[model samples]
Target: MPTLLRLHTDRPGHGSGLRLAASGEIDLSNVDDLKSALADAVAEIGSSGEELVVDLAEVEYVDSAAINVLSAYADAIHRIVVHPYLLSTLRVSGVTELVTVDPVQQ
Candidate 1:
């Protein structure tokens, strides 16, 4: 299988908040790309430090590197949108407080 990870940012309300929609697998192979994508978004946010939401609805698998990326950005993020299966991993990883999984959205 091809190792692919996709990340894009959505600025709702014309710059009020950033929604990072990530899909595919996030493992060591694409960790750097993931970080770069996030860094770009943060740079785009400018100095206002607006709220950000990470939408991971299409993500089916993740590795430690991905978790680390999330950890690094936890402070900048308002919440994380994830899938049910990934919830336990985030919880056990002790990041449940910043993550949210909506059944309807999933």
Candidate 2:
């Protein structure tokens, strides 16, 4: 079975900042992909104090398992941008307390 989540990573030319754009549905079945992507991003950023910008504006859904993955990398993540509807879930899951969560501007 294929995972429903898709992750895209981008590194800026000159800083410790990196961006990861995720789309599709995130659930337990495919949570590993999210973890792997974050892990790779962290490795790339190395000891430079990686600050990640997660663009989840196109993400339609995310389950608890996916939230856990994001939390695991909270220290490395600078912010997470998601569709407005997903805000509550991330907040209720305590992700908002760990990192910045913003709604994508129209």
Candidate 3:
């Protein structure tokens, strides 16, 4: 199996937003890790009023289990920017309404 998950966080300054960029595959095997990572990221933001941006530009695959975890965390997250490739998968799986998806750049 590929390494499949990379999480990077950045806090620019006081009241600045936190960016959680995820790369690689998110499947049943690593769905728990993804959930844990998101939980930790949410904790780090800690009601500071800073926005949380989750960038899924590098996620190549997402299984149903991953979607369920993401759906559970959607309300807690500020925004979810999923790559274009995953949008259809999410929609088909009925998870698009649970989270927001930023428009993919051309």
Candidate 2 backbone collisions, by pair: none
Candidates arranged by lDDT, highest first? 2, 3, 1
What TM-score quantifies how close candidate 2 is to the native fold? 0.90
TM-score of 1: 0.84
Q: Tens-digit lDDT track for model 1 on 1-106?
A: 5579888888768756888888999999888888888788777765787877778888889889989888887777778888888888888886766554342262
Q: Flag clash pairs in model 1.
A: none
Off by over 4 Å in 3: 1-3, 12-14
What's the alpha carbon RMSD for model 1? Answer: 2.3
* Sliding window of 10 residues with minimal summed lDDT for model 3: 97-106
In model 1, which runs have C-alpha deviations exceeding 4 angstroms? Answer: 14-16, 97-106
lDDT of 3: 0.80
Superposition TM-score, candidate 3 onto the true structure: 0.85
Alpha carbon deviation, residue 40, candidate 2 (Å): 0.4
Q: After superposition, how far is residue 76 of candidate 2 from its true place, in Å?
A: 1.0
Residue 106 accuracy (lDDT) in model 2 = 91
lDDT value for candidate 2?
A: 0.89
Per-model C-alpha lDDT, please?
Answer: 0.79, 0.89, 0.80
